[model samples]
Target: MIRGQCLITNKDDQYNDPDVAVILGSDKNPTCESQSVLMAPKIKLSSGYDMPILGFGTYNLNGYQCLTAIHSAVESGYRHFDTAFNHENERQIGEALRTQIQMGNVSRENIFLTTKLWNIHHDPRDVRRICEHQLNLLGFEYIDLYLMQFPVGYRHMCDEILTPINDISVLTTDVDYVDTWRAMEELVKLGLVRSIGLSNFNMEQIQRIIQCSSSKPVVNQIEIWPGFMQKDLVDYCRYNGIVVTAFAPLGQPNREKHTPIYFFSEGMKRLVKKYKRSAAQIVLRYLVDYGVIPIPKAGNPLHIKENLKIFDFKLEEIDIRALRGIKSKERLVQYENIKNHKFYPFERED
Candidate 1:
């Protein structure tokens, strides 16, 4: 959002930046090309906007690791970064950008940045203020995309919409989703955010908001994987032209029990052997082929290196069909507290 004119202060422009270490010495690295980027798809979202198919995930990223990961991801050709207010690493994200600028690795123009407005900041009046606070914390001019973390609104408030029964998180029918969306729209119009999106919202909530918004949201960031494939929601969003951004692409490891690597079923195992790839790569590529951008989480450089090596071999149709048939519909990060929220749409009818 650096308006007046775009300036490059980093390495050289891989995609329009003037800075990203361009060595026109005519020395091509055969190894780099052989690994991937052969048929790498440059995905464009609904609004004709493009970002790298793979993005960097910073969910539990904190402290020194967050800073280092941000730098490493960039040097490795990751231009899209996803962070949230709850992540508590905005300052580090900002610090890494400054460090890379000094290192001549990346520039402001070459990155597509996204951050979320926490559920606590969903108030119609306070949304703008909260977004401004995020900008200040991230030390950026303007955010590339900002998302309302979920369908969070104050509960039991008696206003023009409806009268209150009691003080609680479960809202009444008078909850004003349109009012909240209008406020978010104002953020985009004011140039505080380039685009607006949603995360953890249900079909009913998104349908209601999209009906009234001045701008249709271009992205729907949510949790989608082989285990927890919310097919109904996926169909609805894709039909409306909302690009899906998946979080927790790999099933989260049971850190406490450290017993979670069961995602690799027999079918996946055979496919991995046939493809000569890791389970993580298979999982990531499966989602990518399904038209959802997968943000695989990893802090270790070697793991991160493996995570992004997804574009090399395409997932065959047989592999995709087999993966689809094996869906367990399991959710790893279901926050049960949300069941008390007014818009708790995760309730299973079955």
Candidate 2:
């Protein structure tokens, strides 16, 4: 039995009870065996659905590589997958998932699929049309979770042009995000999507939607890592019953030549040695303990399996404090092209 006192029956059932906890077994081994596959703990969303606490991100993954990665991820016991319309690999992801289901590896009801509505389709009138198109591409009956990609809206030059640019900057539109959210609420009523959410949105923007719309967002996907822990935003979302989904939880790769020194701090080194885990596993486990669902992307099959092995261990309070104490703060996924948009969510550096 797992350590936590709470018991959860019917692993696939969505419950409103706050007392249920889905704790994993106490096996610390990371081997990839049939009996050793770990089921990730599920967090209850305000939408009355259960989401796995960790997911596999599909950004920049396409063609044969995307299919192979999805196969490896399913074999590794990953039930949740994160993808975006802008990522342009929905068809391949859909096919990979179909093949898995046909092979008796997994079922649709056991999987959680999350996709985003791009900035260009933020107009309320265009929201459903684009969502339908995405569904057609993915060959799904309904999306598990649909997210507004960003607070900022862009000019819709055409369906083909994802990012319409006016010389040096992205063309901006004044469509209110609240209206777009209202359209998403309609998707829930029409059985097109199970839950709706926000991505790259600040607290103020989220509050505005809450004030204006009858439906509330259940999740907020954003960039979070050890060095750039947005404590305030994370806390605020948790307080409001909105689960935070972390993208780039292990931080962006190859963009920066050298890893930040904080990643190799004495505290982290000690934890790595003590846990017999890699630095990436430590960082991912730390984020899960901090109360956010991390979606880390990896191309290598070994690395993909390694990412799922984090649920076996729990971080100590002192170790969590040591990670929180790191002084470096950097935002890696800044959409600099949309910085000047009226609805841009991040702070503008002058």
Candidate 3:
């Protein structure tokens, strides 16, 4: 059974170091920042599990880099990890986590690990097979949370081919997501996963699932940042008791020529100076305060430590108002390839 209580700390007890020098020191002495790093508080999921509000995202990380980043994140006091089978790094993640467990750094019970079921495996028959394969890759008894990767389904060419395509576009399957959700609920009953949820699914899709399934989704993972808050959808999910996990919470500032305007806006600059925090830190804190878990991916050691420090401070109401008022309505992660599918969640862009 997954068990734990939320670790509530006073706002004044937050670590105040702006440089994060203590947490970024040499790995030889791992205990240097043990007491300095503030552990993130946990939010109870409807599935009866406690998930840390700030999670580590492993989307593009692979091989040695992936392993090293996980170690760094663990050292920086991160307890929640987000990955997908399509991310293609579960094997390395499992190895890194197993190493940590062997070294007595963290236990399985305390770590909240979340992975997704790929669209190709949406057929109810293939769901269990793919989940078990993922377990073998992860080398875990059961997953903490397993999310339906998207509302749409894709053709199953083979186990290795994640995105099977043809001359027309990506080949989509006729499998209904409700059927996929039913198969996922079976996973919970069979002890393959502790909790089940949805990802990249819009409000209408989520409503359909709620109407049909006996086990309601505890989470809806999606893209959320200052630029595109998806207010109505977020409000709908919250009203239905579904927790939102924000991916790309920093707005992918590294994207060439497409840097999020908020990153350089004078308003954001003022808030950064006022709080003595980085732009990334301010946005992350704002999202958390806005009531969602932000899983920002960082391979750099300094960034890993910096991301974890947001738990120490609370964003003021006026600052929150300023952030919410940002007018840019750009959505960063549009899965354009599958947009033509009948169940494509987002509105078709011209």
TM-score of 1: 0.80
The candidate, 1 or 3, that scores higher on TM-score is: 3
**Model 1 residue pairs with clashes:** 11-19, 11-20, 11-21, 12-19, 12-20, 12-21, 13-17
- lDDT for each residue of candidate 3 in 220-257, tens digit (9 for 90 to 100): 99999897888888899899989999999988885466
Clashes of each: 7, 0, 0
Q: Best by lDDT, which number?
A: 3
Candidate 2 residues 1-350, lDDT tens each? 11112224434443334533453322232223324356577877898988988899999999999999998888777879999999999999999987877776667877799999998998889999999999998889999999999998889998889899878888889999999999999999999999999999999999999999998899999999988889899999999999999998977645356466666667767999999998889999998878899999988999998998886677788888888888867798898988887888999999
What is residue 296's positional error in candidate 2, in angstroms?
Answer: 0.4
Q: What is the TM-score of each candidate against the true structure?
A: 0.80, 0.90, 0.90
Ranking by lDDT: 3, 2, 1
Position 174, candidate 1: lDDT: 33
